[model samples]
Target: MPPHHVAWWRPLFLIALMPIGVLGNLEGDALNAFRQSLIDSNNVLESWDPTLVNPCTWYHVTCNVQNSVVRVDLGKAGLSGTLVPQLGLLSNLQYLELYSNDLSGVIPVELGNLTALASLDLYQNNLNGTIPDSLGQLSNLRFLRLNDNSFTGNIPVSLSTITGLQELYLSRNNFTGQAPDFYNLSKLENL
Candidate 1:
């Protein structure tokens, strides 16, 4: 290839690499925010270095080949404290497994932003407050286990629209009023 051709490809490669760098930083910041909010008595999150380009290398965190955060496997790590809203910034997140922890406080409404989410496992925690209506936006979601929490309020009616949902676990919560009809949830096997 000519010198000019090589130079042209260099700029294009740099442009394509820019977003990955930005995404790495954004995801790193988001995960760091979670670290800041938690009480990691077991030092499970001690490897989460804020200066790192991305959290993909951190323990309990998983990322896709594109370096985008896809899952957070912090279940039963003895972590306590509230969830951070910055976690919603992980646009490509799929499975969020924060279950079986001592995490307290209301679930952040921002969690609804994880549109690509397929499995949301926040069960076995002390989360309170109403489930965010935004969670209904997860059309791709199949497994939603919010059971065993202190969450109150009628399930969001929008959830009934999730035809792809297979397992719905809202039991063991303090939800009041008649359960919203899941008659439309054709794929639901567990309620």
Candidate 2:
């Protein structure tokens, strides 16, 4: 065999499968981390066919050529469970909506790690616990809705740091204290 010839037994024989391998890694991580919640909540991925070879082709799922999950929305879904911080592993996630679900858990501080996030809606859920100050790190956030939940404690002033925020909905939560200064939110259009 030539030095450049593909070897059947060699794992490196299929260099083209690298991207598929990456997709598998991502899918495996997502499945492992949110296994229980995903299985319990149809709202998050009601039409998703996990049996498919690639998750990118599933309903409500979008991906780049690399087959990475960029959005996950299950608004008004009948889901119930805590949000696993491992969700932050989707480095490319931009939109995440789980509004009006039966979800109950702390808003993961790790979510603030999603620097590319543009929209986040978890309204009307049964989620309890204080808003994480780490959320202020979503510099690209344009929409934020966390209304009507059982969350308790003072609103995180750090959240006011999102410079691109347009809509801010915190109505009917257990939040207390005055609004944070709006200087960091220069492009804010609605609240």
Write model 1 residue lDDT over 45-162, tens digit each, in one string. Answer: 9889999988899998889889999998988899999999999999999999999999889878898889999999999999999988989989999999999999998889988988
Query: Considering every candidate listed, which one attains the maximal lDDT?
Result: 1
Q: Count the backbone clashes (under 3 Å) in each candidate.
A: 0, 0
User: Looking at candidate 1, what is the lDDT of residue 116?
Assistant: 94
Best by TM-score: 1
Colliding pairs, model 1: none
Model 2, range 1-191, lDDT digits (tens) per residue?
87666566577656767775766466646644664565453444544555556567666567767677778766765777788887777777888888887888798888888888899999899888999998898888899999899888898898887888999888888877777887667787877
* Candidate 1 to truth, TM: 0.89
Quote the positional error of residue 143 for candidate 1 in Å. Answer: 0.6
